[model samples]
Target: MTAPSVVVLDYGSGNLRSAVRAVERAGARVTLTDDFDAALAADGLLVPGVGAYESCMRGLRAIKGDRIIGRRLAGGRPVLGICVGMQILFARGVEHGVETDGCDEWPGTVERLQAPVVPHMGWNTVEAAPGSQLFAGVEDERFYFVHSYGVREWELVTNDRTAAPLVTWAEHGGDRFVAAVENGPLWATQFHPEKSGDAGAALLHNWVRTLT
Candidate 1:
């Protein structure tokens, strides 16, 4: 069987190296590139993000990853968006005010945490959706998360109508935020599975297995 080619989109953001290595360790042939052509041709795509959501979206738009992502999704290719990457998949994000400051509304909006602190760091448990392939053989357990802004609502409403599925994995049902979302071939997680130790590896393996 041909090994699945996993394309990791790079846009000069946070520690993507860790993500590259982790995906490789999961038995995928990793290709690190920002080129839209190469990204669109992959068997599966990984959109991992860190730092602020606005900055991440800006870089993504600058490099045209947004278009490539849309094309791939339209073509039915599986995708995994991590961290801030996941936040950008929604309709809008209220993070960092970069999107709001520029007079251009972001697709998703993040809100301030009422928790004791802003950025919710460390490990937190995740409850998978009823039938999530991303959580295959994986129990609902703690994954690494470090962020202040999170997805407020999974289903975005506009013109007095509801939009499509934003993040479809495991929704952070509590007062925290959206943890993950799963929609057919698309899966996104607010937490960094690459930083979740063995469980993270398991998640990566399951993701690759889905592509196969």
Candidate 2:
């Protein structure tokens, strides 16, 4: 069997190398590229984001990454997003009172956390949704998180014709927010699995297993 091919979409996001190395360790043939065709044809696509939401979106747009994501998902291709990468999958995000439209893959607003201390950092446990393959062996493990903004509400409703997406939850300083999401053909995490140590590697491995 061949190792799955994964493209780490490099659209000027910060600290992309760490993600590239992490995914490589997860048993994938990783390629860090901004080429649209390479990203679209990969067995899996890794969208990593850091810094502000608007800036991330700008970089993604410049490389036509949004179109790449839309096309890939339309055909049921696997896409994994990390950090602000996950945040951009929502409808929009508000940071410092500036609102930017996201990929609109899901309906929700990424807003500041109501936590006492902003930018919830460090290891935290997650309530993985039932039947979550991403958390299969790491259900009880803690993952790393460093963010001040997140989707505080779960707004994607499904009909009987479609299975509901599995949503993960985590809390910080008395405020709860989305930690991860497992929608069909699209999986994302607000935390940086690449920096989460052993548990993160396990999670990435699980995601790599689902690639075509």
Q: Which regions in candidate 1 have their CA more than 4 angstroms from the true location?
A: 96-108, 156-174
* Weakest 10 consecutive residues of candidate 2 by summed lDDT: 13-22
Assess candidate 1 and give its TM-score to the true structure: 0.86
Model 1, span 146-177: residue lDDT tens: 88777665544445353334333332324646
What lDDT score goes with residue 79 in model 2? 98
Q: What does candidate 2's lDDT look like per residue over 103-198, in tens digits?
A: 999999999999889989999999999999999999999999989999999999899999899999999999999999999999999999999999
User: Among these predicted structures, which one has the highest TM-score?
Assistant: 2
Tell me the alpha-carbon RMSD of every candidate. 3.9, 0.7
- Evaluate model 2: give its TM-score: 0.99
N/CA/C clash count, model 1: 15
